[model samples]
Target: DAGITQSPRHKVTETGTPVTLRCHQTENHRYMYWYRQDPGHGLRLIHYSYGVKDTDKGEVSDGYSVSRSKTEDFLLTLESATSSQTSVYFCAISEGLAGGTQYFGPGTRLLVL
Candidate 1:
């Protein structure tokens, strides 16, 4: 697991509720990414953090937000859960933005009804 962690690996919730997913890494890598996997979408980046307190939005960042207060932790939150948000989310870590292999943690499966 490379010291990477995700909380509540499986969750089921109502559409209007708020949901938060967490990703923690002990590797202390420079780049951490959040991605969602769905049937047709394959894998889409949701958000990413390059350093403590430095984060950026990704293609599917419409209803999501992320925070990184330390080198080892990254947090993702959904303001309002929706059925369309149901998917497997993965957290990845990399040493560099380009050319480095990104190691992924076991995904968190979320179902919004």
Candidate 2:
């Protein structure tokens, strides 16, 4: 309800390819985060941006990268797709993490074979 969306709700691809996921928001929140969901890890942070052009890597940023050039848009890119990278990706936005409130996008399901 706040304002968030993710592109390519479902995708299937061979390994070693490149993939890019897009996240958009209309609420203009100050913080945006990218996360990957796996069976054991639950949701692990991949990257986050606190402001336009101000971004940082997170725990699961090894095979991923993110950029936030505008207040309403954030993009996540996978340099090279891998079977291990097959997972559900979620985009979230919040005023800040301290408040324990975040709006999540529908999510992208990517598969590599």
Candidate 3:
């Protein structure tokens, strides 16, 4: 990755193992999204939640699950992650709708070996 984030920002994990990444925001934005950025794919949405406990699957939702038990926190879990799932994951928060301006957090680079 770009090496802009902190220590846990760059993670190296193995395949078939469960991985959970958290995005916590103190702003309490209404819309939160989890997106993965790859070389060719650019950024693909994995999941997004509008409110606490109200979530919707995105285009690349397969093999991924999300939970939003609180408005300030969003969790993205990969059940038995595979090599194909290795990418830079990002969490974005927006006050308006989906197309509105979004503030993105530092990416978490996950390398599944």
**Model 1 vs. true fold: TM:** 0.95
* lDDT of residue 80 for candidate 1: 98
Could you give candidate 3's per-residue lDDT for residues 22-113 as a string of tens digits?
88887768899999999988999999999999999998999999999998889999999999999999988887888668888898999999
Winner of 1 and 3 under lDDT: 1
- Model 3's alpha-carbon lDDT is 0.87
In candidate 2, position 100 carries an lDDT of: 86
Question: Residue 68 in candidate 2 has what lDDT?
Answer: 89
Clashes of each: 0, 0, 0
In model 3, the runs with Cα more than 4 Å from the true position are 1-7
Tens digit of lDDT per residue, candidate 1, span 1-113? 57788887999999999999999899989899999999977999999988999999988999999999999999999999999999999998998873369989899999999
- RMSD per candidate (Å) reads 1.1, 1.2, 3.6
Angstrom error of the Cα, residue 106, model 3: value is 0.7
Judge candidate 2 at residue 51 and give its lDDT: 92
lDDT of each: 0.91, 0.91, 0.87
